[model samples]
Target: MNEEVGSLHERLARLEQLLTAAQRKPAEPAWRRPTSRESRWAVSAAVLGAVALQLLLPERLAFHPEWLLPALELLLLVLLFPGPRARKRRTTSLLRGGGLTLAGTVSVANGWSAVLLIRGLVRGSEGSDARTLLTAAAAIWLTNVIVFALWYWEWDRGGPVARAEGIADYPDFLFPQMQSRELTQADWEPAFADYLYVSFTNATAFSPTDTMPLSRWAKLLMGVQALISLLILALVVARSVNIFGG
Candidate 1:
């Protein structure tokens, strides 16, 4: 009887040790992060929805029409790239941050424009009054101009290029050389995070250079387009106030 009790105690100790080991085991890895493609699609959907709402909604219900254009432009930008399946969390976060910032700026500008219109209404200024409407419209246009100009300046100074060709693809040797390792999905998370941090923190000073400037004409066209947009925004606001009598 004494021997049997001792054996039973030993077995119990072994069982406890096994249980502790099992408890200490790490869990399976978390689901892989979404790819860049997924993020771009999400952004695109949000933008398209915003645009559709602006066009379809009543004036009283419209959030900001001025926002629709810039939002669309930003969406087009992200969609241009064929992003990898595995992206870094930081990268996606930064992209979302930038998008949100752009959206907020547009929304605020639109709100201010509406405020001007409302004030005009309270003062019994008719929307048909050219001077009153133009003044308000001009203010809105200027706001958009300033915003777009800054965006252009930042891009010209050193914004990321989606892709480079020929001499335009010259490498940067000034910074410490990162090892050219093929990035796996796991690797993408950290890399994307670092990419996002660098992109936002140094957006103004991150231009890449090569022997030849790619699409110099295209850059000029973009500037022209921004100017055209500002003009259109002004005209539309002026017309809209008059048409709606608000």
Candidate 2:
């Protein structure tokens, strides 16, 4: 019975130590831990979806050479590679640049596609299948979501690799949970999913919700995202509905 009591006391003491350490540096979310799996999954899924969407789009809607964007994106993804461990200085710099470039390219491509889709709808569908047109709009909008998600993930306090290394000491966004101490644990670094959720909500609501953009760049990016999403939803979606005579 004495041994059991002693063990319980030790466990409580260790817990207290950990909590104290965490509180000492609550600002550094990545304080003492390595990058987690959520970051990896988020980026990998974005790349896969972007490539798939490129293939699924109509040849006319895709760039002049349908395979070019996908090939280039695949090459960039390969360049970053995102291996299991930290990379050398030069290599890490290249990977970071390549990742951001790929994300920007994805955003531009999807935005252009949305524009083209809107043009087609306005030009008159005539005998074009309404369902097919609607499908294209949906695909473009979804690609927009993925592209912006990547942007948020990449630009928020530098990229994932930077955050993992505890390099970026500042935040580009101020989430509600961050302001409330009781809301989340000390080790809660914003994951890719958190940014993805931010993008998703921004697209859906056409404005910032709980997460406030702190930097000028973040504000601009969120504004652009909201505008593009509004165009796709208001113009493309509404046009599709009109075509169906609803």
TM-score of 2: 0.79
Model 2 Cα displacement at 39 (Å)?
4.4
Pick out the ten consecutive residues of candidate 2 with the lowest summed lDDT. Answer: 30-39
lDDT of 2: 0.76
CA RMSD (A), model 2: 8.4
- Residue-wise C-alpha lDDT for candidate 2, range 58-127, written one tens digit per residue: 7667776777778888887776666535567887677778888899778767776777777776676421
| Model 2: CA > 4 A from native | 1-39, 125-127
Residue range 1-246, candidate 1, lDDT tens digits: 999999999999999999999889664222222322223443344344434433442353234564555565556446433433325656644654464465455445444554555555445453565564555455443443343333432232132222111112322211112222243333232222232233222322223221112356424534453454444455556666656785
lDDT, candidates in the order shown: 0.42, 0.76
Worst 10 residues of 1 by lDDT: 159-168
All candidates: TM-score: 0.31, 0.79
